[model samples]
Target: MSRPARAHLLSLDEWWESGEDREVRVELQEGVRIVAPRPRPAHARVVLSLATQLSDQLPPGFEVLIEVDVVIDPNTPATVRVPDLIVRSTTSVEFPITADQLALAIEVMSPGSRRTDRVTKSSEYAEAGIPHYWIVDEDLSVTALKLTPGGYVATGFVGDIVTSTPWPMRISLER
Candidate 1:
């Protein structure tokens, strides 16, 4: 169910342990609450398809998840990013996975989320040391970004990117 927007500073523990049914998609931005609308059909489809493909090709220890909360920053007034998809370790049966467990964080850009995905999340994921990040635009243009000491750098590839970054697989950003 949706709730009226209000100011709530959420901690990592309160955010995870509070099991209230959060129907509206809410993400914590440095302890502040931000709500996002649900994804469109096309966005949802791409996420599911990518998850299926990734799951099929992933090694035993890694699994792909869709629209899950990731603890981007663990400090108080924490930041939790709900990425479109993530390739994380299956070893931990945790409710909300930390950035260290994540191998890749994927964001399917929406009309309202283009800037956040490309700039905001890109920097956040890099700062959290997520290793890899991918940005999928509405036109199915995929920008594969790898984390660097300087920042996140685009691999200069589009559509489909083949990688052995912890796992070997070919991910196609096609319909």
Candidate 2:
């Protein structure tokens, strides 16, 4: 008889515990591993620009997080991530993001990052129950996505004018 497909299993807790010694950021979803490269200068610029703009517009008690790991669970499938920009309305923000704490997550697509963002992370964020997830493509000049009960659905594309409110007020994205 053919051997059953060999399977390797790891609790999500182990994944988070292991990330401390790794070189780059790693996240897990249902025990699957994901790795992403460090941001390039242009990518960094976009993240910083958007972070600054959002920070300025956000009201008190809310804050913008930059390149920090957002832990999505505390159980065996504990998923952790470092999104480009995370806007939280909570007075205190901490790691291990639960379903309710996370308000919005924005990812700036890097070269060749379309598949990962549009597919992998998209599914994972939805599973994590993050309210709003936006994927920003530098080349296409587009900010796309809308969170739904199942996952993120590509609803609209903003080339020059992008408006949303993770914070109390509206913030726009140009270019």
Candidate 3:
């Protein structure tokens, strides 16, 4: 089936009010709507487990948020991404928190999203200066990256316990 195409570039507000946003698993990146396949049951399970685990060990002042639209840039040609999880400051009470308030952005890799998570998102998150990014595999091992002036560098660990920064909290997602 053909998806309906919008002619104009979308801002954050337009994407929110446009009923199309509610009708699908869509992300708006640089003003275009990107539709992704529904996540499989196993993928959803990992996301849930991570959210619960992360929240339990969360440091003071930070909170773990499940799939919610993260406003990367609120301009007319907007960029919004809904990651599997986002660790953000508790200070921001808004529905879609801006990128600066994000401490870490986590992506649980689904089969269809491997490349997008590994390559595309890492670039975008770094550009947004989110500081840390976690790429969780299907088996639940995490590869964490730390942002630098140039880009993200692998901060991979030795075992099940993985830690990220802005604050130190060890996360064990091992099965």
Return the TM-score for each candidate structure: 0.87, 0.76, 0.87
If the candidates were sorted by their lDDT against the true structure, best first, what order would they fall in? 1, 3, 2
lDDT of 2 by residue, 1-175 (tens): 8999875545756765565634665666555567666678888888887788778877777788887667665566455666888888665546555546667788889886788777877887787788778788876354555677665666455544345544344335453
* lDDT scores in order: 0.84, 0.69, 0.82
| Candidate 3 residue-wise lDDT, 1-175, digit = tens | 9989758889888888875454457988899988987777888887887788778888888898888888888888999999989998898877768888888898989888899899988988998899889898876677888898988988655346545365656766654
Worst 10 residues of 3 by lDDT: 157-166
Q: Roughly what TM-score does model 1 have, to 2 decimal places?
A: 0.87
Candidate order by TM-score, highest to lowest?
A: 1, 3, 2
Q: Which ten residues in a row have the lowest lDDT in candidate 2?
A: 166-175
Better of 1 and 2 by lDDT: 1
What lDDT score is found at residue 171 in candidate 2?
38
Number of the candidate with higher TM-score, 1 or 2: 1
Off by over 4 Å in 2: 1-8, 19-22, 149-155, 167-175
lDDT score, candidate 3? 0.82
